[model samples]
Target: MKNLLVTGYRMNELNIFDQKNKAIVYIKRAIAGRLAPLAEEGLEWVLTPGQFGVDLWACETVIDLKRERFPQLKLGIVTAYANPEEKWKEDKQNYYRNILKDADYYGAVSNRPYEGAWQFKARDELLFRKTDGILLFYDEEMGEASPKFVKERALKLADEEGYRYIAIGADEVQSMADEERLSSFD
Candidate 1:
């Protein structure tokens, strides 16, 4: 796929409040592993909803891949609505701003700031239309997680429209961490 939408749980949903949590490294590695093959297969852009967790991590992963390996891979931050960080803490807002600064393209699906859940649905619709596939960092066991909504939408479209949807779950991330630890001894 040429364009891919990378999305997943928010920081609160993941219970990861601190940005420097060492666990983030493993998450990024898993994302990179998933994307590398896609990049080789002509994945040109990674689009994310710009949430504070996997979405921003995915952006960093894409940026790292662009700098170190796949120069053609680009990051796009498309939020559900404007002012996505308005209610966020100072540090979190700054982080979002920096991610936007590095983005190849940035926009809000809804021009206005968040009004209701409708904006999020609009975002999914817009992103699905623009992207050829989705890479979701979500687990079905997180039953009430925000990513579940996105996952449901992806599943519906995958069979009906032949869209691609890839999910990287806790097992995959744990494996990535294991791989990283094993490789460090080399």
Candidate 2:
């Protein structure tokens, strides 16, 4: 997709470079800030409402709007994260809920509700096999994961397993990555 929205929470822990939650927040925000220029060229990255949380964007719609505004614009959607608890959340979940509804393709980085609306398990597996890009969702932030470790592990797993993205809480990024437990999606 020409545009993408990457979403997740901040890692909870503060130590462990890989697991350092603050790092995750800084990095995600940095990425979004860097991508701001792309918005002018038909791509943009938008962070979620929560601080050090999920990274999302309004690219597809922007592209569509761009197209409507400037017919020559080309566009696509590439979602990077989703929550397993999405089906259960009440008020704050609507934005995510809408992402699922509007997404053209899922990142499949973790488990998600199949009955709600979008169900891409099979497609996710196929994508994973090809190592192209699969749906991604961060697991909960553990009390002791490191940030660098999280990025390292995620990079390794994504390389080996064909994941498009890995979701991590602001506090758990590094440590969680090092922990590398089986994602519920698996």
Clashes of each: 0, 42
How do the residues 34-129 of candidate 2 rate in per-residue lDDT, one tens digit apiece? 344445565422222221233333333333444444343332333223454355446436545555454344454334434442333343233334
Q: After superposition, how far is residue 52 of candidate 1 from its true place, in Å?
A: 1.0
Off by over 4 Å in 2: 1-8, 11-29, 37-52, 56-83, 107-149, 154-186
Q: In candidate 2, residue 125 scores what lDDT? A: 32
Model 2 lDDT at residue 177: 42
Q: Give the TM-score of each candidate.
A: 0.92, 0.33
Candidate 1 weakest lDDT stretch, 10 residues: 140-149
lDDT of 1 by residue, 1-186 (tens): 899999998877888889888778888888998999999999999999888899999999998899999998889988889988999889888888887887999999888977999998888889999998899989877667888878888899998998899989988888877887899999
Each model's lDDT comes to 0.89, 0.38
